[model samples]
Target: MSAGNIRLYSYWRSSAAYRVRIALNLKGLPFETMPVHLLQDGGQQHTPEFNDLNPQELVPVLMHGNRILRQSMSIIEYLDETWPTPPLMPATARERQRVRAIAQMIACDIHPLNNLRVLQFMDKTWNVPQAERDTWTRHWIKVGLDAVEDTLCDNPSTGDFCDGEQPTLADCCLVPQVFNAERFGVDMAPYRTIRRIVQNCLAMDEFKAARPENQPDAPAPGGN
Candidate 1:
């Protein structure tokens, strides 16, 4: 297969988009970024063009040649399968499941509750106050991170990264969730293991480059 043309539809502050960015950076694949301002003009994601691209009207849509891939985890897995030099899934079947489980613990269980659209709906439709909305965000993040901490703490497979010493699907899912936690002022002290993993991943160039504030469209690091 040819090394295909790649394009990424992304929003600067989107954790899901950030996850795909990290995966792309780690794979050392160059791709064009097409910004879809999730909050501008009543969310450009809801526009007819973007909606046609993804009926869900979500960010981080990966266009691999003719294939349009949605869902951050699925996109990353596609990248891993298509270009398998540094594998994201472990060689062992059970260990790969462990990594995927840890990843899904955040992607499926946690992120859906606190996503941009969900929070926006809470604020606009339900009239939730800013403080209450923050509470709502932090509450889910804490719950998810707590479970992640337990998983990492108990699982012997965990190393400096989520699985073994090298970063994997687990770490790709994790760094973005931690970013969301810090954004909402979720106390990191309670999840020491999770914080340690976040710190280790942040030290890497790939994670740093993929951070929300690192994007061209993002506000300065401390601005938000």
Candidate 2:
């Protein structure tokens, strides 16, 4: 697909959607933003129009010409392969596997448990209280982060980014997960490497430009 033909369906606070935004910006690709309000009127994503685009009813859906794509990781891989400007993965298979491993540790293992739908299910089905819910979020996030921190720290390839110096797919996944963790009151003091890495990402204009607070659909400061 061409540059201007890209469109992203995103929610301001959705970390999965946020991941795609960062990837798009890093690739220097210009795209239109189609906001999918996740909290307004019981979520616009649940509507038939949005559901038609993605039967999964998820955000971060990409419309490239007539080809519709779902899933944040898959969409990002597509962008990297198609664009291939600032590469998101290394040339070597070993490094690519490592980057993907780190990304999946967050996307599959950690993030899925703390998604909005999962939290909603816990509340409506099990009647989980708010305080208990916060605890639930903290517990899972902390557990997953512990694994991520270990993965990054033990590896010799870790640098300013997740791999060497260039921002890879792993870094794209990390920054958003860190943001979501902070929102849910997961402290950063325990993970110095993660905090340092995220600081490096935030310093870059592309990552900063993709932040949730800067999104068009983002609420006013402190306004849900």
Best by lDDT: 2
Consecutive 10-residue window with the lowest summed lDDT within model 2: 1-10
lDDT of 1 by residue, 145-180 (tens): 989999998568888989999889889999999888
Give lDDT tens digits, candidate 2, residues 16-81.
Answer: 999999999999999899999987889899999999999999898999988899999999999999
Question: What value does the lDDT take at residue 98 in candidate 1?
Answer: 93
Alpha carbon lDDT of each predicted model? 0.89, 0.93
Tell me the TM-score of model 1. Answer: 0.96
State which candidate has the highest TM-score: 2
lDDT of 2 at 148: 93
